[model samples]
Target: MTGWLPVAPCTPDGCARHTGAVRAPLPAALLLLSGCALVLLGVACIPLVRLLGAGPRRRLTRCWARAVPQAFGVRVIVRPHLPDGAPDGVELVVANHISWLDIPLVASVLPGRMVAKREIRCWPLLGPLAARGGTLFIDRDRLRALPAAVRDIATTLRSGSRVVVFPEGSTWCGRGGGVFRPAVFQAAIDAGATVRPVRITYRTDPHGSGLAAGAVAFVGADPLAASLWRVVRAAGLTAHVDVLAPIPADGEDGRRALARRARAAVLGPGDLLQARQTAVASDRANRPAESVHH
Candidate 1:
């Protein structure tokens, strides 16, 4: 039962790792205006995109998604874990939830149907656009609605379309992430779709650095405007979308086990060790004082 959506303990004050260097106020304002304009253009045209064929619409979506980040001065790098490159098949793309940028970051590389919370349907500009873009809405607060949602995802996957889901169900700071909720994995198993684990990490510099960019994180009650402004002002913001190996849809593996395997893949290649340390430390710091003593 998914009556209770998984929530991250991360808060902007406690976990957001902001960049030390920032763009000048003038340049940042320019980037912010450009980013907002691009987003508005994309959202306003969602309905009109239906005039084009499915293939063309998908390409446009990917292009727009990629352009938005660039307008905001955020560099994106997509890495393929396998030698063959990103797989072409019906897949359930599951990723570690981080910033709001995670959605477009994934779409730029692996365009597909997205599974999102139903509440998004009411968000101002982007909400209606998401609905028109063929997003699958899941009622995470309604336990009974989950079964039907899973069935719908399975049906879509069966129709040979890829589906992207943030199985963590909530946004976490890039320094850490919540466990991947197993409910969505059921849809992949039901549809016999390969599970593609993706790891999205944000850094202050494009070149690999130890500093995690919390400036991009959208967690807890942080206002969207504030997060967006921080992103546009940040200096040298970079996002890495690492496409981990694909996990087979083994009917024998229950959703829980399948979710574990997927999470493992996303955290593999030495990431899990660092992630475990960060997650544990973050969790401990965020824990209630009473619980910390206990």
Candidate 2:
């Protein structure tokens, strides 16, 4: 709920042209059903995870994550530029928040447990599915819960498992988002884990208008159902994820510094340039038409 809420401006006729282009009811229904089936399949496999251990559980969860986006007609493109000789031990994967799709987008390629807000735990079927997938929920509204959440994340990393955290704390339009919160970086420091910064941006097909046509962003106050509908109905949506070089959580860098560096990497040149281009295009599209004289 950090970025602009209203849809971008349309033409003089007052039609929400851009919005209308992305709303396909039939496709939405089909995509929703497909996503539900995938979730149900994951739910059914939950019992086996306990018996088989982390390896099987992670693999199953990864498959479910990868399929969810495909169900919604969203493709994930990974651009990894990891440093050579980086530690392959436990990792803390941090990325920018864009939409609920972000969960699966990140999970699909980089398999790991996620650190999500506590509200996700009460979202009906999704709640149980997330819990089963090894998600660690935190009550962001409560300051007292910070230590406990950090401890849980550290413990997970110390166990040689990767943990994903959205340091931005809230969702935003893919063009740009809020600053990264530094509290979670303590987990990486505590566990002596490497912090991997991943940048995720959304774009539409070349034949379409641009990223806005894809309508994958879940910003502002839009309800979950409505957002999901827009995503399912969108055409040629693609999520571009860039996994930057990993930063060491050594004594030289503290939690605050680590968070700053992570944010800088995630909001690198490519991301900033794209954001500016999107903003400029939006401005041009929203401009009023000049009246012609005889």
Candidate 3:
């Protein structure tokens, strides 16, 4: 369905193909239906908390979000590579946000609460579900709230619920990597938990033709529902989620260092194809190196 869309100019440096936006009919209908289902599901689950428990209800919500892409006829590709024996305590997943689909994209693979801006928590149906699901809403403007937010995040992690944060603050086209807002990384530092970085890309190639940067991109001032509708209405959709190894909480290099490393991994090595290969190789190298005694 994505193939039917036209490509536009991508201002991001490394994005080679003209970016395509999603504004199709099929996706529009599916998004609406899926959203309605989500709302209805939440309403139904509200009463079942006694029977299902918060954990079960949360799990169901995650499952519903995971199924959204399919409802819109889009396939989600997730490659999550975690370090061996990563601590079971709370975790912070730092992923790049490309489009509104990112909410579902990140939520689908990562099973945990989210650290989103205050706005998402009030976004009609989703807002209600997210708040009820235990998502930690951060009021970025209120510096006084930082300590409490950190404590809350740490508590959630200690309780075994993961938190996904898009440090960039907002979503962008997947054409290039964006800077990780330093303030958001504080939670991971304060909580003494590992930070896992992830990269996301959406392509039109149904057969996985490397990446079709030209066929899909949602950016700037474009209303979320309208942009998403464009993608759903298109002919085909394929997306990839590359999860890099998690960084230790106590790095000699600070969170900023980890952020730099993560940005490189997501952006690749400048050349698109080369960057992909390099990322794969680097990820392989970062694995706890083994020794062969002579």
Whole-model Cα lDDT of every candidate shown, in order: 0.75, 0.68, 0.59
Index of the highest-lDDT prediction: 1
RMSD to the true structure for each prediction, in A, is: 5.2, 9.6, 10.4
**TM of each candidate vs. truth:** 0.88, 0.79, 0.72
Give stretches of model 1 more than 4 Å off.
1-3, 81-88, 273-294
Cα lDDT tens digits for candidate 1, 77-185: 7786222233446999988887778888888888888888887788665577677778888766566676688889899999999999887667877654555667778
Error of 3 at 115 (Å): 0.8
Reference-based lDDT, residue 58, model 1: 72
Better of 1 and 2 by lDDT: 1
Better of 1 and 2 by TM-score: 1
Clashes of each: 1, 0, 16
Give the per-residue lDDT digits (tens) of candidate 2, residues 1-294: 111111232221232113534536787798888987887877777787668755565566666777888887777677763232233359999998767888887777677788877778887667888888778877655556667878888999999889888876556565554455666788889999999888877777533346652266665455677667777787677777777889998847788788778877988866666544544544344232110000
User: Which candidate achieves the best TM-score against the true structure?
Assistant: 1
